[model samples]
Target: MHNRLHLTYANQSDQEYLSIYGKAKITENRQKVDDLWSSFLKVWFSGKDDPNLALLCVTIEDAYYWDQKNNKAVTIFKMAKAAITGEKSDTSDKGTLNI
Candidate 1:
């Protein structure tokens, strides 16, 4: 498993939107996103049975297929899976999942 997860916007518009939203909504909780992913990784690597794993996987799958129009979400899910599997993904210079 990787140690970090890097999120990149799918396009300039998406990047700008996230920048604005982050500044406005997450200004006081900048680490909220990172913390959430960190917790997810921890649970994933715990080696113990986690009932939520199935739900989480299903949710990601749903987002990838149902939200196909949202390139950002698709990229995130793809990269996240690659990170967990220690496999090289098709991720380009566009973005990355550090962990």
Candidate 2:
């Protein structure tokens, strides 16, 4: 299993990245199961009290965020725009947070 993943969150400005890093753990805690119960889970489970409900919990090792980060489609547009405008293709605002 992979021990780490690079999580990316969209932020409008460089100072707004909401990224977080950690060791991922999974659980089926009943309290958590009930709190986040959704109709989607009903497709596979009997109900909130179903014994199969699983929740993802993480032990954060680090976190970071980047601002002005665009999703794939937007990034493509930025590249195209740069091609036409002769301006530097800006993918996003760069920033980092280690926590």
lDDT of 2 by residue, 1-99 (tens): 875655666544433557777776678678777688889877999998767766777777777655556676788899899999999987866555555
Global local distance difference test of model 2: 0.72
How do the residues 1-99 of candidate 1 rate in per-residue lDDT, one tens digit apiece? 322222223446443321111111113233443444455466455522333422111111111111133467777888899999988766333222122
Cα lDDT listed for each candidate: 0.38, 0.72
Give the poorly placed runs of model 1, Cα more than 4 Å off.
1-11, 14-70, 93-99
**Which prediction has the highest TM-score against the true structure?**
2
**Which sections of candidate 2 miss by over 4 Å?**
1-19, 69-91
- Model 1, position 8, has a per-residue lDDT of 28
C-alpha TM-score for every candidate:
0.25, 0.50
